[model samples]
Structure formats: structure tokens, C-alpha cells
Target chain A: MATDRPLTAKGLATRARIVAAAADLVFHRGAAQVALADVQAAADVSGSQLYHYFTDRDDLLRAVAVHRAAELVANQGPVDTLPALRAWVEANIALIAADNAAGGCRLGSLVPQLAETDPQTRATLSTAFHDWIAHLAAGLTTMTATGVLPPTADPHRLATLLVAALEGGILLAQAQRDITPMRTALEAALDHIASLATSP
Target chain B: MATDRPLTAKGLATRARIVAAAADLVFHRGAAQVALADVQAAADVSGSQLYHYFTDRDDLLRAVAVHRAAELVANQGPVDTLPALRAWVEANIALIAADNAAGGCRLGSLVPQLAETDPQTRATLSTAFHDWIAHLAAGLTTMTATGVLPPTADPHRLATLLVAALEGGILLAQAQRDITPMRTALEAALDHIASLATSP
Candidate 1:
């Protein structure tokens, strides 16, 4: 059974707005820098209203993590084929480039700060990453089944590596305020994947 | 010219102790959570003593970053050969496992939290990473010059990927509290390097 009760349409809208604002603030400002009042101010909601939607700051932070994870998954679009998978990887790199490397991967940046400090937030972020990796793995599996990749290719392991490379690249790019590291890292990951293709 | 004035032998020891204590606190507790008082308490120094050693908290943080970076470089030992490089990669993964994934890479953990919010900190971290990449690239260059690696292998680019993979793998391992992702990701990176070796 679900822990949270279903909300009406109006309640859902207000909750979504609060989450969006919180996510924005947390991403731009470090999580530690953003307080409940900042969230309330950004969301344009009163104190009682903020409490009504989420029990406390930690609860809202967990929600923001989930919201950001879902946004990343959705933005990735579909990835059932090899070309589609490459596109998915490129799209992530493009996002960093588009932002001019100001902000790195939403999950990558936030998860590190919270993972060791808070257990609950760590679990939320871990599950989010596992789910994202699963999506990419499914696409790699399709590639193997469709004869694009060799039978020996392990989709889950490969997917994990791809995610790691992307996160690492994003971190480097953000620190340097340049996108070359991100691009080169992702391209290297793609080349590795290509090497696993069935030899024609 | 040097920006910081030279210190007496006793002063150097005291400053090193302060930095070591602050680095420990910041590593266990997030950077934002550790204050100057905590650093002073941990380092066993008075208010004036702490301030006299460093201009402020930010200066101390930059010192910690530099100290941690040097520690990592020193701990990595020598990485002149392909075997040496593989050993370096394994040592990093071993570090995550040894800590039980409690705290990730010391530099990796702190850099992300500070990089986006503070430009000066970002520059410090970027230089540290660039220095790290340069070290790895130097090893790869030796491999190429010795004819161990193919001439076509770009040492700088390959070094960048290796660093990226290592950081990414460490982040993933810390989040999941498991070392498999890091091991797998790094093995894939090593395999890529092996593929570049020249034939006997």
C-alpha cells in the first residue's frame, strides 16, 4: 500500500510548484545553503502551506531529489536502440554545454553532498540512480537482442560504466567551467560501447 | 613571488596540525557543516591562533584542498607503466572499500560542494585536478615513448578519461555503499588502456 495519500487536482498542482521551486533553489544554491524560508519564498507559499505539503525540510529535500530524478529520466526520452542510446548520452552532454557548465548533473551534484551526511537522502538518491541505470541497461539489452552488440556484452555492467563516465565528466566540466572534459569523457564511453558491437 | 609569508618551524607544525584537523572535520562532516570553532576545537588552537595562521575560513579550506590533493598524489605511488597505472586505479577502489564507503574521495567529496557556489574554490579544485591529470598523462607519455603503447594513443586524453572514470566510480561506490560499480567501471577503463598496447 502507498504511504502517502492521494491528493486532489489543486493539491497536486501546489505540491508540484513547491517541488519545482525547491529543486531549482537546491540545484543553484548548495543544498545546505537553501533553508525552509528560501523554499517558501521561492515557491510563493506561506509557512503553513509549506508544512502542509511536506512534513519538514528533509522530507521536502527527498521530494526534490525524486522530482529531479524523474525530470532527468523524462528528458532522456527513449533508448531502445544503439543510436538512441548514443543520442541519450549526447543529450546529457548537451545539457551541460547548454548550461555553459555552470551546473553539473543534478543528481551527481546533490547526491555526493547528502549521501554520506544523511542516510534517508542517500537511499532516495541511490534508488534514483539505479532506476536511471536500469533504463540505459534495457536499451543495451535490446541492442544485444537485435544483433547490434556481441552476445558477450553485459548490458547492466556497461550501463553502469556509462553512467559513471557521465557523472565524472560532468564533475570535471563544472569545476573547469568548460565542456571539453564532459564531451571527451562521453565520447570515450561511446567508443567503448562501439567496440562491443558485433564485428561485421 | 609567494603570496603567503614563510613561517617558523613551530608555526609550520601548528599550521599543518590545524589543516589536518580541519580536513578531517570537513571530510566526515560536509564542508558547510564544519565551522571555524569546530576546526579550532579539533586542532586544539585558540581563536587568535587559528586566525593568525590563516586569513579566514576560506583560506583554510583552500589549504585543505591543496593538502588533500597532495596526499592523493603521494598515495598513488608511481604510475609509470601500464601495470603501475592499473595498480593506481585499483588502489583508489581499495580506498573506497576500506572506508566502507563512509566518505568518498576526500578531494572528490569536497570539490563538488564548493565548486559551483564559490569561484575561487572552484579554481583551486580545478588546478588540483589538472595537476592530477598531468601526472597521469606523464605516465601514459612514458608508455608511448617506450613503445609500450601505440603511437596513436593520446596520452592526455586517455589520462583525462582515467581520472574521470576513477572519480565517477568513487562517487557511485559511496552512494550505494558497495564497491562493485567502482570495480566494474574501473576495469572497463583499464581494459580500454590495455587495448591500446602495442603487439609483441
Candidate 2:
């Protein structure tokens, strides 16, 4: 919870429910368009339950941002080697395909739909993306240490490209209702990274 | 116009004005939340003036997609050469910097913001992207033809990555209020393409 108040396990579950419902509503529809009443109905929570978890709309959105950030970051697996990165990419593609490419990037779908977001919420979302980028960067750094890639390869830059391929590819997938764009984008970025491999 | 009826020059100007305003509105605020009335006010046109140009909202969005597509395509300078593509990237970067990184990609900005778009309208937007993708692919193909790149270079795939970088990079730029993500993404893709060039 964004609130510092201690929560029981049941209380934590309820808060998670509200945030999940709020995230879904905000993703399909713009944040400015989804009302508290809609979130309450979707979560099957009383107004008291909603109010107990969040103080206001900004607070709720911030919580959603935080929750989503953690989820997105946690979703990434190993990326310290070319094979591992390929596996990671394929796993993500499978997830999207399983959803029939309906769900865009879990966090990215919410970014553009937000209107008049507070600076704090915006920062939270930005930090979430950066945190994900840092994780990928860390893997690339490990690859360098393991002699999988040349030290000349900039992990930060490569990671940035990989993440963009993901965010942008998902957008393309949503538009075309096909996974080719996403797959191609990810492969291109991965190829670029693999191109930096130290000849074994 | 998506409508078959041809318009006079002044009519075309009015229609273009309406689209630019509507695109701006849709880019910042989601399409579902933006009303026809709001577009009318933003464009400073009477309701008749608005309806005279568009039969309804879907027609208007289709027009906006068309208008934005043409504009984005025209914005790309010659990309048949590596240097030309680099220059193109820098020009785009300067444009974003000039705006203080406020505006996102010209076409991609409206994509996720639209909710429940009509099929025809969605197809129009998709084709618009494909057109840009084709343009970039054509450039890479030229490289293969001119022997700038080897025959093994896959133009379509490379081009997809390039456009993804642009769209995804811009999304990152919007989130971070910095141009480095977009720059890094474009460079990484460009480097991949450049790496395909045969040794001179």
C-alpha cells in the first residue's frame, strides 16, 4: 500500500484487488474517464473499502503505478546471455499470443491513456520503466564480465533499445492484431546486442 | 477526406485544420474522452462547419489518421543512405528538443489513446504505419541494391525495428522528459543496419 498504515493479510488482499481493478479500468479506458464508482463496482468493494485503501484519485493512480511497476519489473527473467535473452523474448511473445495479443505491455498500455497525471505519479511510472531498464542493463553488464560480450558494448544503451523494442512492439501488435511486429522488433534489438558478442 | 465527395481548396484547408486540432486533442487526451463538440471548439469551427467536413466521429478519426500519416511520411527525408538516415534521426531529435520533448511521435501518439476504434479506422491507422515502414524498408533495399549492404540484409525486418525505435523511443522520451532513450534506441537500430554493410 502507498499508505504507511499497517495492513493485515486480508487488508493487503483487498488493497491489491482495488489496485488490480483500477489498473484494468485505466488501461482500457483513459484514467480521466474511469470514475471511482466504476472502480468500486469492478472491484466488488464498498465505497468504504475503496476509501480505506486510497485517499483520492491521485493516490489511487500512484498506487496503481507502484503496483504495476513492481509487477512489470518482476516479470523479467534472466538476460545475462544471448540464449537467455532470446528465451525471455520468446516467453513474452508467448504471453501476448496467449492473450491473442489483446493485452499490450502491462505497464505501457496505461502510460498514454493517462490524462492530467500528477508529477509524482508520472515520476513513479518513469522510475518503474527505468528500474526495468536497470535490470536488463545489469544482465548485460554480467555478460561483459562473463566474456559473453565486449566491454565496449554499452549495457545501458542496449538495454534501452531492448525495452523500447518491447514497448513499441506491443503497440504495433495491438494495432495489427498480430505478433510479427513485436517479434521482429525484439529480434532486431537482440541481434544488435548479439552482434557485440566477443567471438568465442 | 474518407468521404468520396471532393472538396474545394478552402474546404480542404478547413478539414485539415479540424484534423490537426483533433489530432492534438486525441494525442493528449484519449479519443473516447474527446467529444465532437470539443473538437469544434478547438478548431473554432461551427457544428455545421465540423459536420460539413466529417459525417461523424469515426469519419473524423479516419481523416486524422490519414492526415497524420501523410504528414509523418513527408517528414522523413531521404533514408536510402546511412548518413541520410542519421541526418533524419538528428532532424527528428532536434524537432523533439525544440518542443522540449513535449510532443510524442506524430502518428504513434494517438494509437493507444484510441479506445474502441472502428475497424476501418483502425485499419487506416495500421496502413499508415505500414506505409512509413515500407518507406524505410525501401531505403534499406536500396542499400542492398547499391551494394551498401550485403544481400543478406533483411530490409523489412530492419525497417520494422527502426520504426519501433522511433515510436518506442518517443514513448520513453515522454515518460522521462529526456531525448536519450529515443536517441539510444534509434542509434542501436541504425548500428544494427550499419553492421550489415559489406566491408569496403
Candidate 3:
């Protein structure tokens, strides 16, 4: 989303380039306001070239949603330790601050825009988040093994809470051009996680 | 905004009626998708009547933003005690459940749609949230007064955190068509708050 994820320059094929341009447009203008002409102009691709990449608007939108969701998971880093996770939140806070809290959480921003509008894209997004939750669940599970977190901690639930807090805080932060909400939410989540750590 | 507040039957004036109808449209369809013609039809007001109430589409969207923000604060109930504050969260969780998390949040849903695109409405929303934070801060301050919260709790900070958690959780919940995230986020915030309670 907006908070993290480094773009992979491994593939700059015509199709991938189009998706990247579309994703950027979606991030700035939102999905509904983004038009294919706009995407084509932004991508510097001809009509046929864009058509070769996608069937229609809905298709391009689904691509944008999937691209962002997958990128977020792919970019997620190690969190087997509480410090790493806190650093992740801090890094996200940095993102909001860097964007002046105006750019918002790129992936999280899509949820409100598309959740009700597109079922197919929504399903695509749902799977990505499911994988995201699983990825987080696995990391937190490892923490329990390393004795970083207490056995009583439910990795799955904590993972979900942390993600929610991150997205919600970003949303709030964006509303006011302030990072305090994002900072506060992340701190609260991290502190709660710290509280569950093996004392000392 | 979607999760709480009862629409008052108190004011059915033409202006208020138009704002209410416009608000509903904005909730279902993002503000970008809400057309002025739709608002007029929805409000059953003539074009002139609509113009009489709103100078333009942006004006009406701003009205919707302002209306929902005020409604949330106006409808907020007593949260002087820890239980009451949590009850508010529970009530919000119930809203996501009742709406199947599909309808999304009315106020929060606006953040992504307008924060960057429409500065005036964003400012309108910012003011409402400021008032909301103040209202919540006032309530949380009372909790410290009544010993419902420890003196260690920063009411303003905690209030921002709670709102952030709640919005973040709801956004996450809506993404998956699941209430688990919302429940998890809210419970985590309340649990943390409870942890700071004056020992028994």
C-alpha cells in the first residue's frame, strides 16, 4: 500500500508498465475517477496497446487492486521479533509523514473505494488479504516459538489487529494531514504487543 | 458515521431533507459517483430547489460531509465510564455486523474519497473530527475523574487512538466481509485501556 512496498524493477514489460501507471492514477485520483483514457495517457500507451493489456475498465481496476495487494505482501519484512514489528509500524508512520499524510495507504485506500463496487475485484482483494493475514499469522507464530511473545498470544488475532490498526490510523491521519492518529494507533498496537512479550 | 447515530426526525426542512438524501447517496456511492441529478431525484426536489440549497455539486458534497460529521458527534452517547466507552465500540462493531460490513463507514468512507480531492470538504470533516476528538477527550477525561481510567492515561491521546483503532478495524473488516478485524482492533484498544485501570 502507501506505507510500504518497494517497486520491483524486474519486470517493466508493456503490461506491467500499464498496471503500474494505472495503480499510480488510482492512488491519486481514486478508482472511480480514473478513466482508461487517463490511464492510457499516463502510461503513454496507445489504445490497442492498452486494450491488449486489459479488456475494459473493470479489468484494469481489478489489475490495480490485485497489483497493490500482492505488492504489499511481497514487500512485508521479518517480524519474528517485537522490535522488527515496531520498526515496521515506524516505517509506515514515516510513509504517512513522508507523503504528508496526503497520499494515504495505497492498498488500504482501495478497500473503501472498491469493496462494494466490484465483487470480482473484491474477491481478488479478499484472497490477497487472506494471504496477507496468513503471512502475518506465520510470522507471529514464529515469534511465539522464539519466545518473543507469550504462548497466550494468538498470532492470528494479533496479526489482524495490527493490520487493522495500521490501516485505520493511516485513514485517520490522512483525514487531517496529521500523522498523530497513525502514530498513536501503531503505538497502541505495538505497546499491546509488547505487553504480551515475555516480561524482561 | 455508518456504525452509529440515529437519524433524527426532528428536522424535515427542505434544506435538511436535501442534505439527508445526498448523504445517503454519498454513503452508497462515493462522492465522486454521486451526481447532482441523482441528488435532486433522491431528494425529490426540483433543480431550482436543489440549487437553492446547494450552489454546486461540491457544495452539496461538503454539506454531506458536514452533516455526517456533526451527526456522529451529536449522536455520541455517554462514555464517562470504561464500560460505557467500550459499549460504544461494541455498538459500532454491531453496526458493521448489521450492515454486513458492506455499507462501510459514512464519515470514514469520505476520508479516502475527498481528503485529497476536495480540500474544503476535508476541512469541514477536519473540523468535525476536531470536535469529535474534543468530545471524546472530554469523556475520557471524565473517566480519569471517576477513576474509571488510571491517571497515567492521556485522555486526548487515548481518544485519538481509540477512534483510529475503530476506523482502522472497520475498514479492515469491510475488506474481508468479516467482523473479526473490527472486533479484534476494538477489543485490543479497550483491553489496553482496561490494563491502565486503577487496580480493582
- Give TM per candidate: 0.94, 0.91, 0.91
The digit string of per-residue lDDT tens for model 1 on A1-200 reads 01267888988899899999998887787787889999999989998888888988878888887887788767767777768877887778888888877767788787667776678778877777788789888988988888989888888888888888888888888888899988887788777788778854
Best by DockQ: 1
Over A1-200, each residue of candidate 3 has an lDDT whose tens digit, in order, gives 21133545542376788899999998877776789999999988998877765778878888888888878877888877877887888877887798788858888888778877788877777777777767778889999998888888888887877887788788878888888878887787787778788956
- lDDT score, candidate 3, position B21: 93
Position A138, candidate 3: lDDT: 89
Candidate 3 lDDT, B1-200, residue by residue in tens: 22133445542387798899999887776676788899899988898877765678878888888889888977889888887887898888887798778857888888888777789877877777777777888998998988877787888877877887788787877788888778887887787788788856
How would you encode candidate 2's per-residue C-alpha lDDT over B11-108 as one tens digit per residue? Answer: 98988889999988876655656889999999999998888878888788887777777888678678998899889888877877765455466577
User: What TM-score does model 1 achieve against the real structure?
Assistant: 0.94
Clashes found in each candidate (C-alpha, N, C closer than 3 A): 0, 0, 3
Off by over 4 Å in 2: A1-6, A28-33, B1-6, B28-33, B55-59
For model 1, how does the per-residue alpha-carbon lDDT over B17-133 read when each residue is reduced to its tens digit? 999999999888878788999999999999898988888887888888878877876775777798898788877877788886677778877766887777877887788788888
Rank all candidate structures by their lDDT, best first, as comma-separated numbers: 1, 2, 3
Using lDDT, give the best candidate's number: 1
Model 1 chain B: worst 10 consecutive residues (lDDT sum):
B1-10
Give the interface RMSD values of the models in order: 1.2, 2.2, 1.5
lDDT of each: 0.82, 0.80, 0.80
Collision pairs in model 1: none
lDDT of 2 at A115: 27
